[model samples]
Structures are given as structure tokens and as C-alpha cells.
Target: MKVEFFFDVGSPASYLAWTQLPKICAAKGAELVFRPMLLGAIFQATGNASPAAVPVKGRHSGIDLGRFAKRYGVPLVMNPHFPVNTLQLMRAVTGVQMHQPERFEHLLKTLFDALWIDALNLNEPALIGRTLIRAGFSIDEILALANSPDVKAQLRSTTDEALERGVFGAPTCFVGDQMFFGQDRLDFVEEALA
Candidate 1:
């Protein structure tokens, strides 16, 4: 079985879900297919803004995120700067996934840590290269891959496909024909595997 994970590096909830999903997939003997999609387009297509844009949801989301983090023992730092632009990070992720999927997972985890925990700005190429290098990839390779026209095109194509598929949010998981949304719904994913 395959679980197609639709995610973006910019989303805190997507970060949380991505961190936990590997273990879940492993236990279920399911293949986790990471599908990097542009969350911005997803939001725009659905005529929806981020949770932070909603007054009530934004306020409660923090508390909920903290609780979810604690429940899973995943660190959640709630960056003071709500939404950080992650276009570069997303492109870099596409590059990694194209060349080194295994390394991509580690790079992704570190990127998430930088985004949600350390609250580091990923817009700087130096920071992104450092993060990738620290995860055991050559900075030059990452830079080269990010500059590849193929990777750039793939990101755009994937984003467009995701929007057309009616995906309007980050952290959505598809198990065969069933669609499950949110990190909180991992239980449903587990049950589906059962």
C-alpha cells in the first residue's frame, strides 16, 4: 500500500505530520510517497487563507498545536513570525527528492526544525545550504540541484496537479482512494492500514 503525503515545508502542521508519518508507514509496512505540493496554490484555489489569517482559528491553533506536539513528543516551538515564506525551501526539497530521497527525509526534518523549532529564515541560501550540508549532503550538490531546470519545472507541475486534484490544504494524506487530512488524523491512517 502507498500513502501519498501532500505537504509543504512552510506549514507547521505539515512539518509535524511529516515527522511522525515515516514511523507510522513503517509499522504498517506501507510505502510513504512524499508528494511535495505548493500549499500557497492549494490555499488560493480553495479561496482560503492560512489559519493565522483567521482570528479565532489562529488563537486556538497554537494551543492545539502545542497539545498535539506534546502528545507525540515532537518539539513544537510556534515561531513568533507566524508564516515564513518557504518557496526556496520547497524548491530545494524537490531537488533533494529528485536526487536523494533518503537524504531528502533528513533534510526535510532539519528544515522543519529550522522552521518550527529554531525559527530560522530559510530564504537565505547560506542557511539552506548549511542545513542540507549538516544533514550529510554536499552544499554544492544541493545548490546545483536547486538550480536544475527540471526540478523547478517539476515543482510547478506538481503544484498544478495538486490544485487540480482538489487538494486545498497541507498535511493531506491519501491512502489508495481514501483521503485523510491533518496530523491529528493519523489514527485514521493507522486504522485504515489495519
Candidate 2:
């Protein structure tokens, strides 16, 4: 079986999913395909805004995220910079996944850890550069790839494909055609995998 994980690194829920999916897939003997898409574009196209857009929902979401993190025995600190513009970040991810497939998992771990575990303000370019370097990535190479037209188009295409598949948010997974939204729905995902 295969689990198509449609994700955006900017979403905390996505981070939570990332932490658990590998183990779930491993136990199920399933392949986990990472589909990196632009969340901002997904939101714009679907008229769906981040939970943070609504104050009450945002606060409750944060608390719920904490509860899940605890349940998963994983660390999650909400970034002070709640909504970092991730256009370039997503592009970088797509670029790496396309051009340097070997480094894809490392890049995901680095960025997710920075934003969710370490609570780094990745909105700042310098900070992003430092984080990439600390994670053994080449900033220049990443920048060149991220700026390439192909990478931009791939991200767009992936986001459009996600919308067409009825995905309006991040961390969506598919077991065959069974679309499961949210990390909280992972139990359904596991059942579908079975």
C-alpha cells in the first residue's frame, strides 16, 4: 500500500503528521510519498484560511496541537512567528525533491524541526540560511533550485492537484482514494492502509 502525504511544512499539524507517518508506514509495510505543496496557494485557491486567522480557533488549535504532541511523545513548540511565508521554503523542498532526491528526507526533518520543535523564526532569510547550513545544506544550491522555473511550476501543479483531490489543507493523506484530512484522522488512515 501507499500513503500519499500532501503536506506544507508551514503547518504545525503537518509537522505532527510528519513525526508519526514514517513509523505508521513502516509498520504497515507501506510506502509514504511526500507531496510538497504550497499551502498559501492552496488557501488562496480554496478560500480556506489558516486556523490562526480566527483568534479563538487559533488558540484552541494550539492547545490541541500540544495535546497531540504529548500523546505522540514528540516535542512541539509553536513558533513565535506563527505564519511564516513559506513560498521559498516550499520551492526549496520541491527543488530538492526533484533534483536531489537523496536529500529530501533530511531537508524535511531540518525545516520541520526548525519551525515546530525549535520554534525558529524562519521568516527571516538570514535565519533560514543559518538553519540550512547547520543542517548541512548548501544555501546557494538551494536558492538556485528554488528560483528555477521548474520548481515554481511543480509546486503550483502539486497544489492544484491537491485541490482537485478535495484537499483544502495540509497534512492530508490518501490510502488509495480514501482522503483523510488532519493528523487527528490518522487512525482512519491506518485502517484504510490495512
Best by lDDT: 2
For the record, the alpha-carbon RMSD of candidate 1 to the native fold, in angstroms, is: 1.7
Cα RMSD of all models vs. native, in order, equals 1.7, 0.7
- Tens digits of per-residue lDDT, candidate 2, 164-194, equal 9999999899999999999999999899988
In model 1, which range of ten residues has the least summed lDDT?
Answer: 80-89
lDDT of 1 by residue, 21-92 (tens): 999999999999999977887887789778899889998998898999999898888887668676667878
Candidate 2 ranges beyond 4 A from true positions:
none
Those runs of model 1 whose alpha carbons end farther than 4 Å from true positions after fitting are none
**How far off is residue 136 in model 1, in Å?**
4.4
Compute the lDDT of residue 37 as modeled in candidate 2.
Answer: 92
Q: Global lDDT for candidate 2?
A: 0.96
Worst 10 residues of 2 by lDDT: 37-46
Q: What Cα-based lDDT does every candidate model obtain?
A: 0.84, 0.96
Model 1, position 131, has a per-residue lDDT of 72
TM-score of each: 0.91, 0.98
